[model samples]
Target: MSSKQGGKAKPLNQPKADKKEYDEIDKANIQKKKDEEKMLKELKAKAQQKGAFGGSGLKKSGKK
Candidate 1:
């Protein structure tokens, strides 16, 4: 079966996929989510290391 790329919007009126295709789609979505999370983590780590925007911690306000 042909594989569809991630992040593409599916039409609401489209027919449902069969078991195998559905499984594949689910797997693809899971992978995409995981990859996105990993990338965000890496980016955050890099930012922390570089002190980008003053690392990952919240800043203290001098409120009276």
Candidate 2:
């Protein structure tokens, strides 16, 4: 009979992983994505400021 409650036990000491070095192209791609996100945020803000669409109900004319 096992008294352990969890599924598996973890190791006491874990080795650290090496840091990844980005190339020029990778860096450029990352920067491009960030710029795109920024532009999208700006556009969204502008749209919100403009407010929602006009009334959906029927329009009434000036004539009786």
Candidate 3:
């Protein structure tokens, strides 16, 4: 294989990408993930508050 194909790139042949653009995109993705996690956590806490449907399900094994 040619050295260029399996080794250091030929700078003249490659197009350079803007670093600032990548940084902005990465920041936006991080913020979006944080928001989703917060929402899921809130939902779980709400569900645990009262799992039973107003005391109207299977009876307890040994309770009055």
Candidate 4:
């Protein structure tokens, strides 16, 4: 009988070298995303505090 006819075979385990490379890439991508999010959050806080183009530095504007 053919091997396929017997049953589905288990997939081969990943080699240590390939696994390490993938782990490093995954970690780098995660760190980069975290850094970008932190920067965006900081920019948003600054923008809210300063108003558009840092105009007037007041939280709200009022006509005198």
Best by TM-score: 2
Worst 10 residues of 1 by lDDT: 50-59
Clashes per candidate, residues 3 or more apart or on different chains? 0, 0, 0, 0
What does candidate 2's lDDT look like per residue over 1-64, in tens digits? 8887776777688688899899999999999999999999999998889776673546789999
TM-score of each candidate?
A: 0.46, 0.60, 0.47, 0.47
List, residue by residue over 19-63, the lDDT tens digit for candidate 1: 655588899998999999999999999877877574576878899
Where model 2 places Cα greater than 4 Å from the true spot, the runs are: 1-15, 54-64
Of candidate 4, the 10-residue stretch with the lowest lDDT total is 52-61
Which ranges in model 1 have alpha carbons more than 4 Å from their true place? 1-22, 52-64
Quick one: ranking by lDDT, best first? 2, 1, 3, 4
Candidate 1 lDDT score at position 32: 99
Q: What 10-residue stretch in candidate 2 is worst by lDDT?
A: 50-59
Candidate lDDT scores, in order, read 0.83, 0.88, 0.81, 0.80
Better of 1 and 3 by lDDT: 1
Best by lDDT: 2
Cα RMSD to the true fold for all candidates: 15.8, 5.2, 9.2, 9.8
